[model samples]
Target: MRKDLFNLGPVFGYFFRKNDPNRPTNFNLRTMHFINKLSLAMFLVGFLVLLYRWFIR
Candidate 1:
């Protein structure tokens, strides 16, 4: 079967490949990781905005 970037093979290879282990299934860990990263970025942006407003006054 043809696999995309998010496929089990690529995803696992990208993340858990360093510590290989037998598992029941390959979950969508990559997606969750991406969401976590995005949330952090958004939080940082908001913090910077707040700081700028506090200082510019």
Candidate 2:
């Protein structure tokens, strides 16, 4: 469970890979993926901020 929580494979795949030729595209799916990417990016930013504060303090 902990390993799964930390796994970044799907995150990298979603952000870096070319679009799947065989995958179905729809408005709902696009919205979901966009939201996921947005959230991940926000999380990374927050983490970086915390790390910076830790080192500065």
- Give the whole-model CA lDDT for all candidates, comma-separated: 0.66, 0.91
Candidate 2 local Cα displacement, residue 13, angstroms: 2.1
* Segments of candidate 2 deviating more than 4 angstroms: 1-7
Worst lDDT 10-window in candidate 1 = 11-20
Q: List the residue pairs that clash in candidate 1.
A: none
* Predicted structure 1: lDDT: 0.66
- TM-scores, one per candidate: 0.52, 0.78
Q: Per-residue lDDT tens digits of candidate 2, residues 1-57?
A: 576988879868879988888999999999998998899999999999999999987
Best by TM-score: 2
Residue 37 accuracy (lDDT) in model 1: 61
